[model samples]
Target: MPAPNPACASNKTEPSMLADSIDALLPQTQCRKCGFNGCLPYAEAIARGEADIDRCPPGGDAGIAKLAELLGIAAKPLNPAYGIERPRLLAIIDEDACIGCTKCLPPCPTDAILGASKHMHTIIADLCTGCELCIAPCPVACIAMVPAPNLTWTETDADRARLRHLAKQQRLTKLEAEKAERLQRQKQLLSKAKSAKNQD
Candidate 1:
């Protein structure tokens, strides 16, 4: 996704700008259980009157309450259509079973999966938000969601996850820009070569 507009960021009091703040309050799981691509998108939808604030299952009742308070509205139960609140979970890859097709890597919002193509992949538990976004893409069915051992979800954890999500987005954006520049350079070279051949 593109970076949030700087012009929009400057006007912090706008209703849509409030959505950016709302996005920060979210868990940054990027799970899409809220019927959107990520927490930011869902927050934007909420700001635009297109979605309710109670749609995040990862946020649970407490998250809903916080969102309600921010929006100055009554807190409601989490919409079951999205998902149910549960203990925080982590993705564990069965290394032996992992074919290492790298399918699970891209869906991870936090860049928690570490490995290269055709090599064994491992999950960085500390960075993982337990979004479960990586599981569905595993063609080998090696990924499993297990309850986070000896850890509880907290605002601090959410903050860390949010930071990781932002970093991942920035990395992806940079990669895309570089790719575009490379393609443009290739096009220019080809054009120059074609002109030279025509002159000859």
Candidate 2:
């Protein structure tokens, strides 16, 4: 018989262990501005009652406040040692200035930069999450986040509502594609079964 699923193994008896498990589920961005080794370790520290909730910069005020509620602690100011939260951005590379030393490439979590050493590199704007992780590593400082102009706020409620509507439609399209893939797989399985029966 196959071994039991790892997820099915019990942590039910240990409530603290359950919290640690929850902490482990967080994205591990090792930016310690969280006042810990990384998000997970800070989360684990919070789970274990060893750290305050307001230390995570990436999580920002919302995350800290949520953790405070979860742990029955008062929500406090974000620790100043960790940097302030910045608006989301897409990094643009100045191709003319980019020598492509590749120092910046290692820091980008999304692999958005394209080019080789000693050549011009460009950012794939669509792929960049604008985490600002790449800005520090650039030897030439050619990459910088500029707010995407298309998303800039307009004075009209109609435009804002329209943008939301478009985003919803895109999400629906993605869901439909996933549903179609599932149906296609089911059809293929049925066809294979019918052929096997005929052969038998």
Root-mean-square deviation (CA) per prediction: 5.1, 12.2
TM-scores, in order shown? 0.90, 0.54
> What is candidate 1's lDDT per residue for 1-200, written digit by digit as tens?
33333333344368767888889778888889998988999988777666887789989998998887777677889989889999889999999999879999889988999999999999999888899989889998999999998457777877887788889899999999999999999999999999999999
Per-candidate clashes come to: 0, 0
For candidate 2, the 10 contiguous residues with the lowest summed lDDT are 1-10
Please identify model 2 stretches exceeding 4 Å from their true place.
1-32, 35-38, 48-50, 148-200
Off by over 4 Å in 1: 1-12
Give per-residue CA lDDT, model 2, range 28-71, as digits (tens).
33445655544456665555455655565645676666655554
**Worst lDDT window (10 residues) for model 1?**
1-10
Give the clashing residue pairs of candidate 2, or none: none
Scored by lDDT, the top model is 1
Show the colliding residue pairs in model 1.
none
